[model samples]
Structures are given as C-alpha cells and as structure tokens.
Target: MTGRLYNSEQIRDIEQQAIAEMAQGDFVLMQQAASALLGLLKQRWPCRKRLLVYAGAGNNGGDGYLLAAYAQAEGYQVAVKCIGDHALLPKAAQMAKKATEQAEVPLLALSAAFKADVVVDALFGIGLNRPVSGDYASAIEQINQSSCPVLAVDVPSGLCADTGQVLGSAVKASVTLGFIGHKIGLFTADGPDHCGDLLLEPLSIPQRIFAAQEYSARQVNGAQLLAQLQPRCAHFHKGQAGHVVIVGGDFGMAGAPLLSAEAALRCGAGLVTVLTRKEHVPALIARRPECMVHGVEAQQDLHPFFLKASVIVAGPGLGQQFWGQQLLQQVLMQNKPVLLDADALNLLTQQTTPQLKQLILTPHPGEAARLLQCSSKEVQQNRFKAVQALHQQYQATVLLKGNGSLIAGEKDLQLLNAGNPGMASAGMGDLLSGIIAALWAQGLNAETATALGSWLHATAADHLAARFGQRGLLALDLLTEVRTLLNQPCSG
Candidate 1:
C-alpha cells in the first residue's frame, strides 16, 4: 500500500518528466494514449459505431480529439463538440485537432443533443481546482444526462486529482481511463462513487522516471498482505495459532464481543475468549460453545485473561460505565497487542496516557471526529490528512472506516475499496475488530494485521453481496466466507 496513489503535483511532475526525458515525443504520447483508449473502447463496445467526444482546451481535449480521429479512421462515425476555443489549445492538442480535421470527423454545435453510442468526456483533467461553472458545468451535466455509456479521459472531469473531492458538477462516468500515475482522489472519498470500471494506462513511461519519484499512498494490496499468513503446515497445532481475548459486551451488549470472538476463531485464531457481564455469560457461551466465556465485575478479574492472551480486542459494546473503564485501564497496562474500537474510542478521547506500542485505533467518521476534536465533515474532507494526524497524535496505527477505508501508521497508508453499500448494517466494525486482533495474535505485525484485516473484512462482505444482493447482508454471513478466502490461493 505504500506507492500506489499519487497527488496532482506528483502526477504532473511525472508527466512533465516523461515529456522531457522520453524519446516518445509529446504528440506520440498522445497518440499512444488515444490508441490505448481505442483498444479498451473497442473491446468493451465493439458493436457501437457512433462516437461523440467533448473536447476542451487542454491536452486532455487533445486526447479526445485524437481518439475521435482514431475511431473515425476505423469507420466509426465520430463527432466533436468543442467546449473550448481550439485557438487556446496546447501544442499537442492543436496537433490532434489538425489530425481530426485531416480525418474528416464532423464537428457539432454545443446546442445539439447526444446521438452517439458512446460519449467521450475530455473536457477536464487533473488541473481542475475550482468549482465547475458556466459552459464547463453545462457540459458535465449533459454528459451525465446522456443514457449512452460515457468514457472519461484521464480523469472524470471536476474530480480533484489530489484529494478525490468533486467540484460543482462531476460526470458520473461509466468508466474512467487514467494515465501515468494513479490519482489519489480516484480511489477515496467521492472518487469511488464517480469512477466506474477504473482502468490505468501507464502510457509506457520509462522505468527510471517512476523509479526516481515517490507516491502519496497505496491501494490496500490483498495478495501482498495475505502473504503475511502463509498456508498453515500440517504439523501446526492449535497451540501455535495464538490466543485472542475479546474484552467488551457490557450488560445488554453481549452480542458485539461474541461476533468478534466468532470472527477471530473463523479467521484462524487458535483460541478465543470473551470477558463480559456475569448475567450474559450463559447465553454467549450457549450461542457459541467454542469460545470460553468469562464474566468479570472487578478490575482484578482481567488479570488471568490478560496473562494468557496473545492479543486483546477492546471497545466492542464497551459502555462508558465504570465497569468498562475499570477493565480498559487494566487492559491497556497488559502491553499486549490491542485494538480500540466502538465505545472504547469514545472513552479514549478523555484519557491523556500515551498509547501502547501495538495499539490500533479503528474509528468510523463520527468517532474519528470526536477523537480529533473536529467535525465529521472535516474528517471526510481529506481522509488521508485525518488518518495521518490520528496516527501522529496517538502514536499508533489508525484505521478510518468509510466508503474507502484507510489504514495509516508511521510509514504506511493503505486504502481498501472492496466493500459495498450493504455493509452499512450493524456489527460490521465489531467483526472487523476481531479479524485484526486475530491476525495480531497469530504473529502478524500491527500494520499488516490492520491492513490485511481491513481487506478481508471488506472483500468478504463484497463476495457475499455479489452472490446475494447487497441489501440486508448480515455481518455474521462473512465468517464462513472469510475462512474460505483465507484457505484459497490468491493471485497478484
């Protein structure tokens, strides 16, 4: 997850370097780009012949013009709707315009309606910084309103390449074709919703150009992270798998820790224990006899559990009552790998103690806002900045859950895009807490466990939703799927 996502500045620098250093001239690069788009477009919709392209005033427009020229040459009727004056176009785009003229592609007036099978959006690219207005806004809306499948060039116009924030009006593209480096906004925040069937074309940038540049963040790579847990050997026993302790489920909230414990066991933890209220112990133990349930009322009751636990997952249904606080304080002192989630995060905001060496903070947007002393809107405004601030402020790994879940540590930042809308249900975070804790108990480092666990949690949910619709997808449904994913072989 380290070098997969980049900011506008980084992508711009790489593009500039490519233009200056590579033997492939700027016009040749544009032609190669158009060729890549044509290949994908033909593969996706070979039967569709009518092509309508919205050309702007930049290199992005140049790409669209060239694509139109390529399609026209292939006998696909093509038309160009110029959103900007061709006189203002850059050198490469002007060259592309000349190419389009030579190809005899028709030019349509802006007032005309869309009649093509596919609409190509080349109006804006990574350089967009302000809210789209006037003709630009009109063009974006027209593209969105069209029933035809739209292909966005480079980026969906109006999206912030640096942060993924949408401008006044952004095209909801059926697909977005990116170039050079992956933009940060395309994977997080509003980017996931706007970008459909994402594809990246490196345009064959030389290896040295990329080798010299650094990235802003990375995609939460499943195969690399899954490698942390090798397929278990036949000789390995339950004792070698490690022990996980779930320390929440106060009074009426017994189900949270039970769900967590079940996930821990399902995800390969050798042993699972739930410490909860004395009244709820019988039912918790009855529902899942595999977990050893212990009821504790006093702080001293945590001693034996902490002594034997390889990792502690705290805060799932851990109410703000004295009973929960008493145990949390002692749990922190145990010096074992711990995950602070649910109500635990709410309580941690009041504490001044320095966090532990292996403590992980998993907070949804609202909870994250509480911990950061800011509004939830502010946290969502720029999630990377927020996660980084949380990691630096608490001096521990932080996982911010949302549309695109982010995992941040001292030197790592990973984003998970495998989840679905169905995950809006309850007990999801509790289940995630268990998965991470189980991995930690089984000997993965805190960062790996957090990143991989996030991936597993989301991917499992996605798998279930894909088979059975996203609605009403229970958190419990993921346990078996998680086991299946863990045992299956993964490809890079």
Candidate 2:
C-alpha cells in the first residue's frame, strides 16, 4: 500500500529492478512465484487434481509452464495448452519450455483446456492494453464458459491495472494472485467484479522498497480508526456532545424522524430534537419521551429550533409538502453543517440557482442520476465520474450509497468497501443521517464526520448482517452497534 501506483510500464521497471537487485535467476523467480500460486490452488481446492494451464508465448506463459511442472511433481495431472507457437518465447520462457518438455506434460490447444478441474489463466497479464481478438479472445470466452474455477496470475488479462477499464474482453478469476503491491485498479471501477477474492503477495520484498515509489494504495479499515479515538472524560456532561436537530417526519411518516432522533441520542448526541408535522408530535414524544418533539407546522417554528442545533439532519420521510419545503429552505439558509437525505435532495433539484456549502448529500444511484441530469444507467456505468461530477457541481461532500458506498469531495474520493447487501432495506438512509449528525455534534468536521460516521454505520450493519443474514436485516439493528463502536477504547 505504500509504493507509488504503477501502470504497465512502471510494473515492468520494478520487475526488472527486483530481478537485478535480488540477484536471483530469472527462471528461479518465475518458478518460485508459480509454485506459490500452485500451493494456494492445491490448498483451496484439495479435491481438484486435474489442472489446465492456458499459456501464451510471453513471460506470463513461462510462469504457467513452471506451474505445470510443479503440479506434475505434486502428483496432479498437468497439461500446458500453448495458445500460439513456441517460437515467439523469450530465453527465460524457453527455459520453462525445456522444463515442461523434460517433465513430459501434454501441450494442448485452447479448446482442449475446457474439461480440466481448475484453469490457470496466464495467457495475458498487465501488459495487455488493447482488445483481445482472434484466437486468444475465443479462448478467453471458452475458458469463461467452463464450470471450473480460474486462478489468474498478476491480474485478470485485459483489465487495465490503473483505471480498471476492461480491454475488449477480460479473464474472470475466482482467486487472483497479485504480486509486490496491491494495484490501485483492483479496488475501483470494474476492478472488483473482474478480480475476485484477491490475495496479494509482496513477493518477499521489504517495506523499504515502496519508499522509493510514488503512488498510493489507500484502504479504509474500521479497526485503524478505533485506536486514535479518545475515551470520554470524567468531566464530560450529557449535553457536552452537543444538540442535534432532525428535521422531517411529515404527517404519517413520523417514524422516520423518531427513529433518527433515537439513533442520535444512542450514538452519544446529548440532546435530540425532532421537528415534524403538528399531528405526529404526541405519538413521537409518547414513544421516545427523551426526544424533545416540536409541532412545527411551518418554517416559522424552525428558526427557534434551528438555533439550538449543533448539527442539522434534513429530509427523512419528509414528504414534499409546503411545510417540508419551507422547513428545508430555512435550514439551508442557516449555513450550519447539515446532513441532507431523502426529500431534501429532491427539493434541491427544484432550485434554479444552485447549492450552498457545509453540506453532506447522501443520495442513492437514482437520486445521483437526477442531480447530474443523467440516466441511472449512465451513473452506474461510470459511478466514479457520477460521484465526482455531483461533488464538483453541488460543491458538497457526497456519500453515493451503493455496493461500494463511495464518499467523494471536490478533490478527494474514498470507496467504502465494507457495507453489506443487507443494508439495502428500509430506514437505512435515515439511520445514516443520525450517525453523521451525532459525529458532527461531537466536534468532528463535516468531511471527517461524514467519512468516519458513514463507515461506522455501514460497517456496523455489515457485522450485524453477518449474524442476522441479509434477508430480514433492518436499520434498527445498527443502533447498538454504533454505540458499541463509539464507546469502545481506541486500538492501534
């Protein structure tokens, strides 16, 4: 994660340096790396003894031939299906060719590789920048069609290791063995889908090797955040965490604001207030008397409530009523740090002018598409573009919630790879608003609060879904988990 991220050329530069500095034989390194991949395959798929290796004429194919030899030594039926003529291979690759010949492993054509138990795809690696066509393309398609699992070396062929773009066709790997550093492309765009269950090996390189490199492979892990946190001081009071005002809960949707207020209070926000329709006040107060419920029928009732809020959460179950719109407009006018969700996003689109600052807009794919004036399909196709465009246009931090749960600003973007599929259910977004608001009230700035808060909420749900399963998981399941995360002692 420390080294500068490299494209195909940079990877080649480092590989050459490693070969020279290590003073190891070129064939030895290739054989050793291939043996590691073979070991992983055998350990993971103990029942599979028949292995098919699809190889090209380059070094990637040389590694494949070395693996075929190891598989044969380990008593597995090994076959090296050479995709093209062997005359194009380099000297080191020819050494591998001699080893495969000495071992007497059968060299079959592309089509003949389909019936094996496991397929080792070494046809292409990071060097591929163009489309896969002709026989190689056909062979890749056939390999994908087979039921056997694939173990890809370096990266899935045809997938750009920088931008994660697919080059015409790409290999689908059940497990991709990455060497040296984890490529930044493997975590973004099409990287997640093409490279499955990625396992990185530093290739026995020391940590200092990355100091000379310039790119970044930043990963967001929740445990790291726990260590930097300070515990609650003895002098801390109930109201010390600050008051959070949650605006919304139009008429019949009282439960949304009520849930949000309760979640905030549980997350250590000192005072929680709910500004909702007049009719829903009594039931909310009755359910959670700890929450100070206000019967605000219009914008006039909002100013007094807004004045007491350290953080504001707008538009949870907030219908597009006149009161809802007026209340949101008044809150936006205050310019205090705000968490925008649900109807607040919808209401913003109605504005002809534009958005203001100090705001976090949490929008799903559909909402993101509307804000960008593009189709949802277009947003999904290039989500990084959509999120970046949204942040640039709106000048607000955006949490574009989906599978990867992207958090983007005007200058930076981080994808939260921790959220589970179970979080797709109801009231989840509202709960997220409460979490962000609580963190902001506790003195975290807008960006840190949003990033840390969103990660915590989503990650907590992921942990819960592990126990409850995704089918019936709900937002309320995260309440105790959030409290637990904030209250726990920080870890290194």
Candidate 3:
C-alpha cells in the first residue's frame, strides 16, 4: 500500500468494521489472530522451548490465552499469566480461558513463572489511554527486566497509538506484529521505540474493505509518486523545465538567497535568479556563476525581476524590519506560487495575515509556535494538530520542521521519516526552501512540491551520511546528492 497512515482512532474503526463484516464469531477471529501470533513466535524463536504469555482482562489478553494454547500445541512449554480475575475478564477472555483450560494450560496471576525463552506481551493493544500504574505497570516493568526477547501485539502497551507519545511508561519489545493496517504512530515519536522491527498482516481481509475506509494518512517517498517525471527525453531543453526566482537576502544574509537559488537550479529548475541586497550580488554571482543574481536595495527593484519568474521562494535571511516587511508585502501582493521560509514565516505570523492558498510555509517549531501564538512545547506535544492548525489558519501547505517533519495541506497530511540529527545545524532550512521552490517551478503544486522537496532534501542528507559521518554534514553537501537523486532511475 502507498501513503497509508492511520491514527489510533482510525485503526479501531477499521478493526470494528472488519469485525462487523466477519461471518464468524469474534472468538474465532481472536483465535486466528492468536494462532498467527504464535506462528510468528515460532518462526522468530525456533530454538526457544519455554514461552511466557502476559494476558490482561480484555480481548488483548484473550488473544494471549489462545497464543499460549497454540504454543503448547506446537510442543513448547508455555505459561499464561492473566492480569485480572476471571469475573472481571471480558467475554472474549472468558472464551479464551475455556480454550486454554481445554488445552490443560492453567492460568496464573502475576506471580506465575517468569523464566521463559520468549515473552509475548498481549496485555494491552491500541485501547491504552492512560499512564501505566499499579499492577499492570509493575508487570510491564518486569517484562522489560526479563532477559528473554519480547514480542508486542498490535502496539506496545502504554503507548499512545494516536500520536506515538508514551502514555507514561511503555513496553520495550524486540518486534511488533501490526494487524490489518499499520498505525501511523508506529513510525513516529515513541512508536519506533515501542514497536521495534514492525511486521504487518492483513488477516486475509479483502482489498475492498480497505477501499471502503478511504484513509490517506500514510505516505511513501516522493520518488514513488514522481516516477513518471524521471527518464527525461534525450532532447529535453532547459525551457521545457521551469524557472525559479528567490527573493530575500538582507544585508548580512546573502548566503541564504544564494543557497536557495542554487538549490532551485540543482533540483531541475530551468533558470534560477536571486534578488538580494546589492552588497551580496557580486559575491553570489562569483560563488554560483550559473545563476542570474540581482541586487535589490529597495522593493521597487524587485518588480521587473518578479514578473519573469514562474515560482517565487521568499524569505531566507529576511529581517523583520520595515525594509523586510515592505519586500514581503510586495511579494505577497503578487499572486504567484510561493514558498515561504525563515523570516518570511515570522513576518506573516506577526501580521496575522489572512490565508493564502498559493503559498507554502516551511517553519521550524519556533517559527510555527510564533505563527500560531502558542508555545513550541505545545506544538511539539502534538505535531499532527499543529500542522492541521497551520493548514486551516493560513489556507496554505504547511511544513512543520522537526523530528518526523509533518506536511499538511487542505485535506491531506504526511510525515517525513528522512533526515538526520546533523540537519539541525544552521542554513539547512534555507536549502530546503530552495528545493521546494525549484519543484514548484517544475509545475508541481504546493503539496507535491513541498512533500517531494522535503523528502528529497532529507534523503540526500541520508546519502551524505553514508559517504561521510553525519557530524559535519553541511547544507551545501546536499547539492550534488539532489542532482544524483533526480538523475537516477525512480524505483517504487
């Protein structure tokens, strides 16, 4: 599946829908799921004879009980520990208890044997919503303490499946088996820590079921979506591509505009031009002689230059002074496809400007916080909401930059798993802004340009890490990598 992402709530809905459509009883599905879990365990640990299953009072635990029975049937010594009393157990749990008893595996409490070759943690699934406390928390702690390998079902207990945040404390597993659709949380935030090497299974559900759901929460890399753009004709010309113009670069920040302009040129923009402070013009031209660099001390100087450009990337080193604001106001006045970054975003947020659909804003957490009139901590707490809020308020494609940078548009959203810690350094964002502008010039809308550019920038960084350690990777290092990526065969 391509670009399929789902939060905890959506996953629950899918599960319920699948259950409703099933002709068999819920117990049958639980048994099949449990058998699948045991099968995975056998494949993962073929040598392990002793098995431990942690079961709770819910359906998750019912799966655990059935797993124990399957393991026992497979000629392995199995032990089951139910977290709650029999009376408190859910209906599924009761059925599973009967099956387990029929198999002669007596259920015990938390005090059951802990010495096992592998531990199956089926105590909780995606229903977790609170902090781990009391006996459940203690049992989770013990599971982590165990030297044996642990496998988590659905999700690790104590993880917020919606946002990938820790509910308080969560189980650490060596592997996680995700049934049906994979939760979007598993690839972001604390999900990675809880869900180790993830495995997905559809449980034989028909493709029509997924089609009925209409979920678009997940996204793959840009190359997969843009495969048709590759393998340019041998006779392709520069004019057939697109032109990108970047306007920014106040007195001391010429490098910002230059970087953006160069990046746009590298990412298949046919012609690249830079409008910056007059003082930096000569240096920019000298550094990258291929670009048409212009010096603009006043906003009036930008008129003629702006007219000829297909896409405009505004604000890299733009300061928030009257001069910067004047330039920005003029840029906004022009109804062009625009990519805004750095001070441009800050200026827009400060002014509380009305939503503009033709613009894409790439803001770091701090910039996004300022735009939303909230604390950075609040945005970081739930990035999904922040991106959604940005899209709603500005009517623009919003790229919230940070760990697992999120891109949100009118009705779609995606998280980028590319990039590295080294990208936290200065000037990386400017480079990204440039790449997006270039893609915009190449006839992609804000969503496609922003998503593709963001992914390509990060992927290039990953490639850089392969050649040289990530320690000193610079934004300029991405230049060659992007060209190579654009020229390579696109593989889905």
Candidate 4:
C-alpha cells in the first residue's frame, strides 16, 4: 500500500502487526533489534571495542540495554549512561536493564566529556514530539561535541521522526540504523544532514507485516529512477525530441536562462529557443550556438517563438523588471507545459492567474514561502506539507528544492536521495528547470519530467562531487555528466 518511507504511526502499526501475527513478544523484538545493532557494529567497525550507550526511559532505551548486554557477553568493553530514572522505565526497558545488570555491564550517570570508541544513541525514537532540554539535551550535546563515532539505533535523538526537524538539538551520528520500515523523517529536510550513511535494518521481521501497511512517501534515488529512459529507434530524429522555449535572462541576469537553455540542449531537446533581452543575445549565441536566442523587445517578440514551443520553462535569470513580467504574462496565457523558477516564481506572486494548467513549479524554500504566503522557516519545518500546499494552490507539479528535494504531483510524492551539499550553488535551479523542460519536450508528462529532472540533476551533481569534491563545485560542472548519463544505459 505504500513506498519507501513511512510515518511513525505507520511504523508502529507495522510493529504491532508483526508482534501479533509473527507471535513475537516485545522482549523478543528488543532482543532481535539489539542483536541487529551489535551485528552491524561488528561488521562495520570491527576494530572498535569500547562502546558507550545512552539508555532513556522508553523501549528504545531497552534496545540499548540489550545491546550493552550482548556486547558485554561478546567481551567488548561497554558502558551505559542511564539518563532517565529506572523506576519510570517501560516494562521492556526494565527487563532489558535487569538483563544488562546481570551481564555486569556498568551503568553510570555522567553528562559531559565522555570518551568511547563508538557511542550508541538510543535515547529517543520515533515517538518524541517535544524538544529536548535539561539533562537529555546536555547528553546529546556531549555526544555531538565528542570525537567518538555514533551509531544511532533507530534515529538520532532529538530529531522529530515525522517532520525531520530538530526538536531542540539532535545527535549527529556517523551512521543511523533505522529499524523495521524506513521512516519518512530520515530522508527529507534536516534528516539527510543529521543522518550519516543512513541504512535500514528489518530486525528479522516477516515481509507480510510490512506488505500490509501504507507509507507516506517514496525514497527516489537517481539510480533507481534512471531505468525509465528507453532506447531510441534508428529512425528517431531531432524533430521527434520536441521543442523547448526558455524565457528569461533580463539585463544583468543573462547567465540564468543561458544555463537553462544549455541544460535543455544537453538533455536532448529537439529545438531550443531563448527569449531574452537583446543584451544577452550575443553572449547566448556565443555560448551555445545551437540554441535560437531571440532578443525580445516586448511581448510581441515572444509571440513568434511561442508557436513552436512544445514546453515553456520560465524564470531562469528572469529579473523582476517590466521585461521579465511581460515575458511571464505571455507564458501563462499559453496552454502548454510551463515551469516557473527564480524570478519567474518571484513575479508569479505579484500577478493575477491566467489558468496555467499544464504547469510545473520548482521553488526553493524561500520562493516556496513567497508563493505560500508563509515564512521560509514554516515551509521548511514540514516540507511535505508545504509542497502539498503548493500543488493545491498552484495546481501544478511542484518540486521544493533544498537538502532533500521533494516533488508533489497528482500521483506520487517523491524525495530526492542522490544529491550532495555541493549543489548549494547559484544557477542550480535554472539548470534544473531546463532539464525538466527538455524531458517534457521529449515526450514525458509534466509530472514525470519534474520527478525525473530532479533525479537527473541531483545524480549529475553527485557524479561530479564524487571526484572534484563539493567545496567549490559549479552549476555548469554537471553538464558533462548529465549528457553522459542520458546517453548510457542506466541500471537501477
């Protein structure tokens, strides 16, 4: 009933179902979870023997206690930092603590300057909604400030499992092992930043339990999405690829639309046309001779070019001047696939609607905030909600760009799982708009184009960052890889 990511409620339901149908007790599940964590630790960090665990008051803490017991049994030096009172611990947690005590694992209460080869963060799990404070906050801070590598049992403590935001402060882990079904929180917003090398551990649950539940969203990595590209026939021609019209590049921002046009060309747009100011025409032609760069003085100049546009990509380098507004007005009137970005999104806020149906809106958080009449902070607090609201308001396929880019459409809600931090440069959105337009022109629908375009853009960025490093990466650095990726037979 679902995809790759599930909310906390859904994960709980799956756990309940597993416990009921699989005839597994809660204690058995905790034991299996702890065993899984220990196995992962041994496999990934065999040289490290000193283990420090933070045991909270929930079943999540119970997992930590059992892990300490299992590790102690295996002769690994282990210590537990008992955060909450043992009397307040859950039934399973009490049993786990008793077992750990039986195993002779030392339990202490110290909040700062802790040293361990590896830290196990089992303080909180998916149910925590309130912000961390007091002693819990101090422990998380110490964990973050420490030099030890952290293995978050299910999720990093202090992070909201549903919204993927920090409740107050979150433990930054070297690796996070998500149990049972993958949580939706682990793949969006700040989730990607806090979760290093995130992985899933099923804890030996039966597949039938998972197959019956529903998920919130899908984790769409570029590698998994690339299999959609089919081989072209020998008779296929440039004419069959479709025409993509780009409007923007007013005065000082000429580089924006040019980047978009180049991206479209590289992604196999049949015929590419750029409607920009006369000032950018020479540079546009000089940069990419194949693109038909027309110097438009008014909306009339855009009229001639719109006739051939299979798809229109607006807003790249589109300034908020009279020129950019005029171009946008003409674009909205056309009954074609339209993509809004950069200044075009900025301009969209000021204009009256023209029934832009076959449309796609690619907005970063700030632009999304402007469109939604909310703060960027609000939009980022729950990215899933913001993207859905954008789609509902604009009635367009919406892609919200950020740490883990999110796409909202009529069918699927996908989050990008392939991009790196290096893509946080100027002109990335412009390039993304172009790629989406090119794919739309080449025969995909607006929604598919937006989703695939997002994956392609991120995948290309990842390919470049893999070799050159992300510190000084440029937007244009992805063009070569984008072309190479489109031509090759990509395996999912």
Please report the candidate that would top lDDT against the real structure.
1
lDDT of 3 by residue, 1-492 (tens): 445777767766666777788765467678778878888887898899898888887888888888888888889888887775657877877888788899998667787665788988988877887888877888899889999999998788888777777877889999998777877777666677677788876675667767777563666476664664655578988887777888888878888888888888888889998888888888988999999988777778788988888888888988888878888888887767888899998898756574455989899889999999999888876778988898888888999987778888865688887777878777899999988888787777778888888888999999889888889888998989887787676435
Stretches of candidate 1 exceeding 4 Å from the true structure: 1-3, 230-235, 489-492
For candidate 1, give the lDDT of residue 302.
91
Candidate 3 accuracy as TM-score? 0.89
Q: Number of clashes in every candidate structure?
A: 1, 6, 5, 0
Query: Which 10-residue span in candidate 2 carries the lowest summed lDDT?
Result: 213-222
Per-residue C-alpha lDDT of model 1 across residues 241-325, encoded as one tens digit per residue? 8899998988789999999999999888999999999899999989999999999998899998888888888899899999988
Error of 2 at 300 (Å): 3.1
Backbone collision tally, model 4 = 0
lDDT agreement of model 4 with the native: 0.87
lDDT of 2: 0.79
TM-scores vs. true structure, each candidate: 0.94, 0.86, 0.89, 0.96
- Maximum-TM-score candidate: 4
Q: Which of 2 and 3 is the better model by lDDT?
A: 3
| C-alpha positional error of residue 474 in candidate 1 after TM-score superposition, expressed in Å | 0.9
